[model samples]
Target: MSSFVTPKKWLTVPLEDVILRIVGGGTPSKSKPEYYQGEIPWMSVKDMNKHVLQDTVDHISQAAVDNSSTNVIPAEIPIIATRMGLGKIVIADFDSAINQDLKALFLPTEVHRDYFVYWYRSVAQKIERMGTGTTVKGIRLEVLKGLEFALPPLAEQRVIADKLDTLLAQVENTKARLEHISQILKRFRQSVLAAAVSGRLTEGWRSGDNPERNFKNLGEAGVEVKTGPFGSALHKSDYVNGGIPVINPMHISEGTIKPSESMTISHQKYTSLEAWHLRKGDVVVGRRGEMGRASVVESDEPQLCGTGSMILRVGEDALPKYLEIILRSPTAVSYFNSDSVGSTMVNLNQKIIKNFEVYFPSLSEQTEIVRRIDQLFAHADRTEQQVNNALAHVNNLTQSILAKAFRGELTEQWRKDNPALISEENSAEALLERIKAERAAAKPVKKTRKKAPS
Candidate 1:
């Protein structure tokens, strides 16, 4: 067991001594259809991950409980999984029954339930070590009963739980704000890309000699877009271990190449589909999934376009980076959204990509627009990094608060202020003895059956 520094006036004892009862639940027979048709919630380990469970994935009839080993657990009791999902704990928010893997601890009046929940979270790692199994690890009942820990007096436990609850709520609020800021950053980036692709971003540069009439369709500017080979032409079985790299929809993301699962095709397969090959300065667009998502090909070596992607070869009039930005922008994305076909999963093809008109200025103006977009994006990136760091710090603060709260550091001043709650009889050791005595007094004596005629 993990060691803890018990504070003055506090005491450590076996877990069972502080609780009224430790009970295990069981499932109704699966073969009996009538047993599972009622309204009682039957919770498995999956339902125990949340702090409070209002309902379960499955419900069983009351007849199921009468015929099976399962017991109905009242609301407010904390339940922990002793089997497969070891250490996960939650409080029952409604009257419920649990499966065999769960153990419910019925707290005595002196112990606070939420405080125990937080305490269990702190020592969950130790409980995990007590479990034994090769395939599905589980904790034996005796080991669970013998686990030891220190806790503050009742009044102090309430105070500590309240403080931690308030502080943790603030941390969660901060995290929610950070996540909202990240979403705003994404929309801002798309807006910048949209403005860059259209002439609106660099409209200030339109002067006496330069006009906005230079916009042209992608195909009119000598750019050709071609989709990869059709479905029947190349099968997944044709892919080999090491050969020419085949870029798929997974490879194109966020205007960059990020291959989800690296794939290659043999030289013979590559030879048949040489028309769909990719080259340096070529723009690759995802044709099957996530329409309009594009990336620039930076490698000089030969690569083939996989079944769900397309390659765009542009002439000297347009830079590959400039067109790549346009393809990823919301302006191009709007076209893809409207033109994409397929009821379930929308798909893109070369015909739709080639005909899309692109507005542009001279090559020099395009370069300036790219530079301006990059500068603004770099600032946003720095802000996003700071937000992420703040989120990490907030999470770390939660753990630190729990550690201090468990060690009596959080309520150290409270203890000094209220000396009466820290007396000898009110300590955890005395509370344990009272619980044991009550349990013994409440036990029923076994009646001996008289022998029959001998």
Candidate 2:
């Protein structure tokens, strides 16, 4: 196996040499509910998500520990997953019992705890790739022990760990802030929609005309609601590779129609189901499943609405874009959800769509409202895109930092500045010799059997 190439003063050693002991864990009898009721945290693969695990989802009793192969690992020790969650590592905050999938490593005093943890994290992906099993993949003990470890002097190890701690923590904080911004952008878009449909967004434009804000049912304001074809009307055999696209509920997202080519129908089928043909300026909506999913058709594309959707043809009194915004608003969604039929899957009928009340503004006012809402929404979309890009960069920055730390690039200056720490007596080779001597001294001597019959 290839070994890790370290600096001249550093040493590359087998992982087993640095570790004092490797302890495997086990699960208590799950049949006995009493075994799980105690205060000791029982760690499994699920609890290994965080870098520093404080508590677990389960707890086990002392009786369970005595009855099972599981062992308690003390706080601040490094625990890694050998199965399922292959590459993860965590330090326990309290003394915790581990299930069969985890292994707790006991290191010598000479090895920096944080340094080992960071190094393990750097090679986690490599370890994961070494895992083997038909079902739950796991790394064998031999494979783990045989793995190479790049060792620097103890002092340099500590310095590298300290630098990583500061850098990675800053990266995490920046990511958290970016995530918070993404959430804010979501709320901002929803707020814009809420204001647009409520007539509040167009209040300024309405000042000169003071036209009567008529509240009328959708049908009264001139909108014809038509449901799509039934299942019997469209068959699977009618679908063709290059045919008219079908607009399904899944295709309608964020006020736009994204037709699926695979769900398309042949020209013959489209001609037979001509009543469901989509027209430009028509607002298509999902009639089943999630409510308030809608989009306005902006093109004269030869597309047929799927069985799970409905069409809203707005008259001159209402703009199609404005109607789409109204249907997708929170107020309309709440109404549809409460009034919709079916216990397993909710559905909307033509009557429900036509009877829904809407804030009817003048045709000119509807145009202005749609324009303002679109402008605001576009701005929010751009901001969200930028935030997503930044989040991607921040995520990559973590691995980049870890790679640099392991390559000795992070402590290059410190190594040059403090040559004594990495030279002769304080070198990595000397550290390994010290570890070897300690292990030999700690070995227990076996007692010789005396001659009983003599």
Candidate 3:
């Protein structure tokens, strides 16, 4: 026996030589009542969203499985999410039926199964590139079967597969930890926003024991509140490429007037209606879909408004930043949504928003409050960034680990320690010989049969 640490043996084989059987999944007819309910797991792409989806969310009766063209994939068959998620692969633990488009792969070659799975996972981008159809994108079975891969020798394959499994395990653990941290950070931000709007955030900044209330209704808070007046005149074609971005309900998010994906209103249109150009410090609140969600205009540069959004121009009496925070508070969000009208497309009209009550402290007090909100929000933003960075790092680590595993590096340490697993000859070749022998021994016996209508 050689004492040369890890084995140096390697080989390459075609995927077509090793692929055992490939099957396409099926879906029972939704219209048939008999196919509606059963113990058998009937899975769709949506069913795979759940992290631990061993059993499916829905089931179809055995009769449905029998009547439908969909075949029942046996246990341990690997199913790939070919349509929606594209490359998301899951090993089915129970007998289940899948949507027709989702490809199911069963490894007949036992030793190569793990290695093939790892290799297939490596080409996620290639798999995504094969996106088909104009509507719901999919990778057809013919396309999937034709996928080419560079396969190493059997002993090397085992080494690579083992290493990849360990590295992926670590990456998955890191990802789980980051996900938990993200949830905690999200909750903290939500809590801070809740406290700010509820008047609890500034609890300590009270007036003296006898100091008269240095406060005014929001109308005196140093800003004017005006809505967009050109609601009826807006059109889709009045949009430009670079000038000012148009604001819509989609742009009017919880706390700010984010620019639309599209730009708007060419110079001619703006010149034709100079009064419609928006200024900074203006708050745009949603008028449809999710009514009353508010956002502030971050840019001093020009912008235009759409029919589905209302532009709130702040007057000199109110602090735009302070008012913007208040609008972002949970209380304000709830208030606007509650006061909103309409069933199909909910909206908070200009009249209701203009008449809405707002509370404010004195100018100096307002400045301090805004400063504190800024500090707290900045802190929250940092925490969020940290969680995001951690998550990103975990994702990168996972890809690296997976890449290293397929490269025959991960199992090097293990192979060095357990030299007994290393054989003098190729392991895959021995396994392949055994399979051929079995097939040769099972030759069909010849039998005489009576001739019919000779």
Give the winner by lDDT: 2
RMSD of each: 3.5, 4.0, 5.1
Task: Put down candidate 1 lDDT per residue, 275-378, tens digits, no spaces.
Answer: 88788888988887677678899988778887888888878877888888888999888888898888888788667777788786678888888898889889
lDDT of 2 by residue, 307-326 (tens): 89999998877888889999
Show the colliding residue pairs in model 1: none
TM-score of each: 0.85, 0.82, 0.79
Q: All candidates' lDDT scores?
A: 0.82, 0.89, 0.65
lDDT of 1: 0.82
Candidate 1: where are CA atoms >4 Å away? 24-42, 45-49, 53-72, 83-85, 125-146, 207-217, 230-233, 238-245, 260-262, 265-273, 301-303, 438-454
Give the Å error, residue 453, model 1. 5.6
**Candidate numbers, best TM-score first, in rank order:** 1, 2, 3
Candidate 2 vs candidate 3, TM-score winner: 2
1 or 2: which has the higher lDDT? 2
Q: After superposition, how far is residue 326 of candidate 1 from its true place, in Å?
A: 2.4
Superposed model 2: Cα runs more than 4 Å off: 1-5, 29-38, 61-67, 132-137, 226-251, 257-282, 287-290, 297-310, 337-352, 438-454
lDDT of 3 by residue, 349-374 (tens): 65556555655655565677778877
